[model samples]
Target: MSVLNTAEIMEILPHRHPFLLIDTVEELESGVRAVAKKAVSFHEPYFAGHFPGNPVMPGVLIIEALAQTGAVAILSQPEWKGKTAYFAGINHAKFKQKVVPGDVLTLETEIIKVKGPIGIGKATAYVDGKIACIAELTFAIG
Candidate 1:
């Protein structure tokens, strides 16, 4: 189930609906790693313009969800509480499969390195135990 619900996640990360992709945080290790979930629904606004009938969740949003999961890991720390994590860079991003409506997207992000306000995370998104995307994300805490 969810360790942190959408409301609780909002307290740590300054993200709101439509943009706030993660529905719940299943696992979290302060400043180290996090695993979150997003239920892809046909009702999502992006499905309209993204495609008329063949609705597919954008690859960029998948990466953003991964970054948001990483932000939860970083922002949950006492020292970093209330801070915002901004994307500094995204490297080695690979999309392996399409994410569509009714899919349960599982996101995991592990903080691999941190120096001052900058951190790097190894992130992955999976659907039904198969990897959908993977990337190395760099973030700046401010």
Candidate 2:
């Protein structure tokens, strides 16, 4: 129901530059579902060696971005604030498209289940309205 800019996102997530992938949260429903965005640029340090002539965003980093977005969703819940969300597991992860510089990634996360300190979520990354990656990510509040 609200939008969270990078400043607000920093309050919930501990990630810093080169690791903090999300730029803005566009939609949120507390514990249910959320949508965020990240703008990939050539200025990112990782683009230097990710490839020489051809630069592609790393798949593992894509998953981490999705996980971070999911963490933001979980942390937005009143009871989960001020806690750290740690990646516990990842399942059925698939990378369907290559992410390059100048791409605006739309990240979506839906809570599948939440029990005590553990939470499971389904996450997907989209570019130009098409899915680029997807996975089931589990997190533990610490």
RMSD of each: 0.5, 1.4
Give all candidates' CA lDDT scores. 0.97, 0.92
Which portions of model 1 miss their true places by more than 4 Å? none
lDDT of 1 at 109: 100
Clash totals, every prediction: 0, 0
Residue pairs in clash, model 2: none
The sequence of per-residue lDDT tens digits that candidate 1 reaches over residues 74-128 is 9999999989999999999999999999999999999999999999999999999
TM-scores for every candidate against the unseen true structure: 0.99, 0.96
Model 2: lDDT of residue 142: 94
- Clash pairs, candidate 1, are none
